[model samples]
Target: MADIDVLRDVAPGVMPAYRALVASGELYSDAAQGMAAEKLQSLWVKLRGYDPQPKAAGQNGWVGKLLRRKQVDEAGEHPNGLYLVGEVGRGKSMLMDLFFAAADVPRKRRIHFHEFMQETHKRFHKIKADPAVSDPIPPLADMIAAEAALLCFDEFQVHDIVDAMILGRLFEALFERAVVVVATSNTLPDDLFKGKPGRDAFLPFIALIKKHLDVLVLEAARDYRRERVQGLRAWYVPANRYADAALEEVFGELTAGVPAGPESLYVSGRKVVVPLAANGVAWFDFSALCGVALGPGDYLALATHFSALLIDGIPRLSPDNFDEARRFVTLVDALYEHRVKLYASAAALPDELYKSGEGAAIFERTASRLVEMQSEEYMRLPHLT
Candidate 1:
């Protein structure tokens, strides 16, 4: 652990660096963001000499036990971390990324909130399989604490009751172990488990968050992402080489030239491969999403993992391919519910995508949603994933 002054000397502050970057026209400047970054920088300083290691094995003696108790008593006083809340594209995740990168903490991790919860669920299930392990939360928290003294979560959200039920216990253990957490979310702590069944049981977790973190609202008025897509076409008709080229260009621009590659997701123990993915955007052929056998669950899972989806070659549908058309409807419903931005090169306009089909009645609703999704209003809605 370096001395506080040494840490300060090594890292001047996040705001100064942030200002320089904004001045270089590399980042959008916001005063609210600067305040949050400054606070994160202060936290970085506080974390310099902070260590989360447990006492040595030989320190079980009475004097060592007394010293350990004192250490435990002082752990909570280490530092209060940050909880940043804002609308989508308000730069919450980007600023947190900058903070995580600039911080010199020895044990730190940055992960998407959904991915973190997915890993947590997997670990819990694995540990619970052993009947002898009565309590899994503490062990899980210990495992996380041993690896990351600082845990930064991006796009923080809670949708599953199982995750909600365990978070209080898991986080309590982590806080006791002096594991600091910084997270960015579109929702406030109080509204995290809103409208969910068994949400009453999740209130304690919300209270835990309020007690441990400094809640900051990043009220940046600009939606940077929507701005990037404002004038660009979101929907393309007559799926042709021109539309194909436009989709490719938009995908590349949104992902900042990151090469797209194959991505697979496990939904209910079945692997669903994405043909192309970069950053948090996924791309797929029409058959990959709708022409194949799939259900609402798979679409819901996809909605939870991606910010935007681009589908290519959506064909016109009739009774002969009603099943595929039905699946497409389900996929659109899921994406719309999660407020995921959509880009597609379809055989025709949304209203003309399905006609003279047994499923055409419901496809009308899907068509309506497709139109709404392309609107600036829908694009401005925060993505749940």
Candidate 2:
């Protein structure tokens, strides 16, 4: 590990770098977002030379069980981390990204909270399956702490009871090993897992968070993400060159700075190849999706992975093509349920798209949702995975 002073000399402070970006017009300046950034800057400064390695205290003289025990005992050695709370579109994620990028610590990681929990459960199962290991939680915590001394989680949430039960012990042990956690959540720490079954058992985890992390509530009059979603020119009628050009622009805007590439996701042992993807935005053609025989599970998987979706084509529908129209309805339902942003160039407006289909009555709800999705209110709802 680098010495504390050495890291301090080399690491550019977060606030100045952020202001520089704003001055250069790379990021718009906002007080609420900047406040959270300042708090992150404080944590950034405090994390220097704080090592999460099991042998951080050295194994020179006492190189066995004593050394390992010493690592867990020194939980008070590092500065407290930060927990940022805010509304869905209030730039909580953006601030998390900024802090993580500017953090000059070794073995740091930034990941979506849902994805992390999924992997955590998987890791726990693997550890449990190993007959050699008696207790899995401590080892799992040690492994995670060793990998990411500084962990940043975006959209920290507790939707599943299984995850809720595991987090308390896992995070408690991780904290003891000098792992610094910075997380962004839409819910306040006290409010997490509230009203869920077994929530009383989850109380200690909330207390542990309050003890180890400085909680900051971020608020802004303008919802930046909602504005971005509202500005979108979505749901065009009678697909033409104009709609094509508009969708291309939307793709460019959403995927700016992120490289465009192909991605493949597996659902139920089946492969779904995304023609183009960058960041959490996916671009697909209507033929590639509804034209092919895909079920609700496939659509759900796509909706789960992508925060925003841009479909390029949709032919007008009737009883002649009820199958595709039904598929379209399923796709829209998945997208709506997940709060995914949608952009498409279709042959007709959503209302007129499938008016005469066998299931067009059901399609009406989809059309209504399609129109509702474009509204600012709908756009402000957070994307659910």
Candidate 3:
């Protein structure tokens, strides 16, 4: 690793030098250097249960595809990059990291989706606000272009309308500037905005993605989280001096104290609040929640603020409840993707959440996802800790 860092700094700007170093195999390679690379490496290590081995030529698999793409790109045709999609715990991010580390791109930038969006949003707003700014988009686009010939994004899911609207323009700018994009996502490009109302508005963005990139699915059936969940019977709770302090800390972290007073908590511009009953139990009206309007951006905000979550009053959601069920599913999906620890006291386990009629199938699917969320392996340790 030390040798690779030195090599990265000292090597002349040529492909043969990198190829020679990689062939010599003296430096210990790692995917942790960049965000995308780290994500890919983590997934690779998890899936293989060990560090990756060198590949043989003509090997045709995920590794092969990536290597082949790297070779083609090295030869200087078009930007040969990959977009990896898969189920949770399938190691899409890990694979991406390996590719980034092994591939010899002159410049590269790997970013987490939320972090990248926040930065882009911040930059865009700053540029718009500056009176001296002229042609902000081109310079900003060129800046990103200059910094990275290859760009990798992790957890690339789209639920926010604003993000959806801008993605087209952003990608358009990126493509025009000839930046190669590689992303790891749980959803397909077409299905990205699934279930978002009026998502047809973003079809052009979807089209642009299809036009610019090749998409691959990693279909290996293993659910790594399932093993982790079964291994750890209970969620981790911090030791506290007092139970009340612990409770307050946990609840505060989860809710961000969105004024649990008389007014309802605003989600996506909707007025929905967590209510405390006579018994002092907290419950939220899932049906009235607006993740789309408030945007999935808040999910990152909430994640940044909280380390642990205890969702109570879920049992109150009736069997026939569709809207609440959908909301719960979305929440679970987002939380799971963020690797958040979840604890809930429900009237029934996920299996019993929907035992009744017509909505049973969808409820069952949601139930399966919920169970996956509880898997001990799936839970990620808090970043702060």
Clashes of each: 0, 0, 12
What lDDT tens digits, residue by residue, belong to model 3 across residues 57-131? 444332223323322343323443457777765546545644555545567777767657767767777787888
Worst 10 residues of 2 by lDDT: 61-70
How far does residue 102 in candidate 3 sit from its true spot (Å)? 1.9
Q: How do the residues 1-385 of candidate 2 rate in per-residue lDDT, one tens digit apiece?
A: 1112222333476676666656655556889878877888887777654554564443432123322322234333566888888877676766676577677776799877876886788889999999998989977986787788889987788878899889999998887667778888878999999899999999999999999899999986576655554566778766789888888888876654456889988666678899999757899989898989899999998887787899987888887888888898999999999999999999888888886737878988999999998887777788877
Clash pairs (backbone) in predicted model 2: none
lDDT against true structure, model 1 = 0.80
TM-score of 3: 0.49
Instruction: Give lDDT: candidate 3, residue 20.
Output: 38
Model 1 per-residue lDDT at 35? 84
lDDT against the true structure, each candidate = 0.80, 0.78, 0.53
Off by over 4 Å in 1: 1-17, 48-51, 54-76, 195-200, 256-261
Alpha carbon lDDT at 130, candidate 1: 89
Candidate 1 residue lDDT tens string, 1-385: 1112223334355665566567656566777878888888888777764555753434432222322322234323546789999888887876786677677678899988888998899999898888988998866876888888789998888988888888999998787767789999999998998999999889999999998899999988688777766677988888999989989877875664345789988887889888889667899889888888888989998898888999989999888888888888889999999999999998899998887647889888999999999987888888877
Q: By summed lDDT, which 10 consecutive residues of candidate 1 come out lowest? A: 61-70
lDDT ranking, high to low: 1, 2, 3
What C-alpha root-mean-square deviation, in Å, does candidate 3 show against the real structure?
Answer: 15.0
Residue 302 in model 1: shift from native, Å?
Answer: 1.3
